[model samples]
Target: MKQITKAVIPAAGLGTRFLPAIKACPKEMLPIVDKPTIQYIIEDSGIKDILIISGHNKRSIEDHFDRNPELELNLEEHGKADLLEQVKAIADINIHYIRQKEPKGLGHAILCAKSFVGDEPFAVLLGDDVVYNDENPCLKQLIDVYNTYGGSVLGCQTVPQEKVSSYGIVASEATAAERIFKVNDMVEKPAVDEAPSRLAVLGRYVITPEIFSILERTEPGRGGEIQLTDALKVLAKQQNMYAYDFIGRRYDVGDKQGYLEATVEYALRREDLKDNFLEYLKKVVK
Candidate 1:
């Protein structure tokens, strides 16, 4: 089994969900209070030397991670050492970028990292969803499963059966490990009535190198894009793939409601804001 050393972040989506604001600024660069959403993705990635698949207006993702010496010097002059460190932290990460050329799909964006990933098993973190778990990052937990299974592991969690239509779901059988299950099949965004189970894939994947070839042959699927779900389906049939009901509070930061909820929750968790923010919330809700 190969060690998972690299990560592929499929950040090429047009982010039409947050349009206008996203028209000028890339959605991945949208901040969750203090840090951009992509920064949270990187912090939870647990793997350095990332290859970010970008497209169209996503240059901000690259610029955000590059050194801003002028900004640094200005902060230094003002003696804002703590703020300066936060700015420098991203610049120091080993990040590489590539444009997807077209807004293909999640699978296509990942395929764009073929040369960078080479033959190693790599983790994929979608920019839309941010899983917060300081004790065990979602992607890192998936890596542990890959190390044990030597195939692929889909980071999943049970969603309401009615909501299964929004995500790719698994046909699975439970394994001895509490929340883990062996994936027998994958169904991409099926109708609620047609869904096999509620084990919805949560977009954190530790995929084997074999998937690059599988994705190459996959035609554009749901929404005329080369869906990652299709490629993973093939991999499951060929070898064992597991779906881990990972530990975390997942925030779908791409959606307005989810983003607002995540912001409030994340803010509540902050030491500086907990007391004041909680009091403010109590007053507002009354």
Candidate 2:
């Protein structure tokens, strides 16, 4: 197997959930605390070469990572070296952008990156889902599984039975290794009663190149959009695919409640804001 050096981030969604706020700013650019949500995805991928699948009104995502000489000069003039370094570091990341051209769906957005990914196994991190892990990044954990197993690996976490309809739930049997499962089947956002299991597939994935061909012939499903889940199901039948119960707290930042929870938790984790934020939280609850 080849080393997973490339990553694809499907950020082309219009973010209808965010509505008025997202009308001007891309939801992927929404800040969790001080950093944009998409930045977390890029950093967690632990790779330099990344392709960002973007769409209309998503120019801010590109600008955020591109060099800003004026801003750098301003920070220098103000003697804010630390802030300058932080801004410069973001531009240093090797990011490539491609327009989805249409709001087809996740599968279409991913298919757009096929040229960039070439023949190598690549990681896909969704902009809406942010996984927080102090020790290992979620994408890295999936890549580790791909390295060991030589097949597609999904980073999954068990969600509540009631929430199974919100994700691509997988039916799988446990493997000999801890926190690993051999995926038998996948259902895209099945009704709670119809769901196979509570093991919902999150945004992180390490997929082999064979998926592109599978996606090519995949007809649009569920809302008349080409669903990645639909393609993955076909791939699962052709070869062994595994799901790793990744260690992390995943926040579906696309949802209003999940965004607030992520913001509060991320704020509480910061040393500069923890004490004051915790006190304020306590006061509010009381």
Among these predictions, the greatest TM-score belongs to 2
- TM-score to native of every candidate shown: 0.97, 0.98
Tens digits of per-residue lDDT, candidate 2, 105-197, equal 889999999999999999999888999998988888888888899899988999999999999999999999999999999999999899999
Q: Candidate 1, clashing residue pairs?
A: none
| lDDT tens digits by residue: candidate 1, 16-103 | 8898889889999888878889999998787778999888878888889999999999999999999999999888889999989987
| TM-score of candidate 1 relative to the true fold | 0.97
Q: State, as a TM-score between 0 and 1, how close model 2 is to the true structure.
A: 0.98
Which candidate wins on lDDT? 2
lDDT (CA) per prediction? 0.90, 0.93
Clashes of 1: 0
lDDT of 1 at 177: 87
